[model samples]
Target: MTTYTPPQRTATLADAPAIAALMRASVLELFPRFYDERQTASAAKHIAAIDLLLIEDGTYFVHEADGEIVACGGWSKRNKTHAGDGDAADDDRPLDPATEPARVRAMFVRGDWTRRGLGRAILESCRLAAKAAGFTSLTLTATMPGVPLYRSFGFTEVERVMMTTPDGVDIPGAIMVKDIDRPDSIGP
Candidate 1:
């Protein structure tokens, strides 16, 4: 058997399709355990939204290994439309990679990589990229399972967001924020 080694690299646009597929798989697997039936479809839609968001901002990234995208994440400058909008912190509608404080847009890792630190690595990679791009802070709406992960990175809960899927079903989410200037720092 081949030993598993974490892949190292960022995904380019060429990796979008596979990365999106991987994202879908990850979400589909979580549907039953993480959400009601109403929330299941939204998981895939969120994957597409992330795909568009990254495409619009040119921030799609992933770590591939053995010809597959095992980990994926995205980053952007921040949103202009929602700059002052409440509860609309992350999406700027048109999406931008030059917003004042950078934001971690999307992150997903394949199941096989669990417990191998890929999630932390992806978060760090996106954080460092956004910081290098001049963002001082990062924020995201974390799913239940992701809460602890974000917390470990110094992300604090800002609010519990009751979000509705496109189908009018509500899902719980945590609006979280992290200070990039913290001593722990960011990067893979």
Candidate 2:
């Protein structure tokens, strides 16, 4: 048996279509466990929206296994914590590192790749990058299905929130935060 190689590099505009597809698949496969059909559809549509800013900023990444994107996620130093395509406005302004925590944004793993350490790897990458950018803490708005993974990364739930889709449906989510004092690891 051979070991699988993890994704190593920043995302680019060329990878947008594949990454969007991965996000949609992930949401459809994973959200059903915690959401109803209508909500799932709304969430899936939202997840499918890819923000090119993250790629342009070199903060987004895609994991390729056999030349296909198996996972995608990223961290952001901007004010927008989370939003999909049409949901977000033109807010790409940088946040004050002196006062604001780095935002962990757009984390998604293909359904076939779940529980395989990909998500954790992407998260560790985010943490290290954020810390290097002078952020002492990090924050993320995690969907209900994503809460467990964030929790395992030592992120504490600050509050329960609802992510509204453009259709006015509210998807349950948690606003979780974590500091960067400890060593970050996804485990071996």
Whole-model alpha-carbon lDDT for candidate 2:
0.84
Model 1 CA lDDT for position 179 = 78
- In angstroms, give how far residue 151 of model 1 lies from its true place: 1.2
lDDT of 1 by residue, 1-188 (tens): 45565676756666667876887777667655778766767755643244454655666567777888887776666462111112355445443334455666667777776556677777777777777776777888777656776787678899998766555666687888877766244332
The estimated TM-scores of all candidates read 0.78, 0.92
- Give one digit per residue, the lDDT tens place, for model 2 in 86-107: 5446357798877889898899
In model 1, the number of clashes is 3
Off by over 4 Å in 2: 1-5, 86-90, 185-188
Model 1 scores a TM of: 0.78
Q: In order, what lDDT does every prediction score?
A: 0.64, 0.84
Judging by TM-score against the true structure, name the best candidate: 2
The most accurate candidate by lDDT is 2
Report the error of model 1 at residue 186, Å: 12
lDDT of 1 at 86: 26
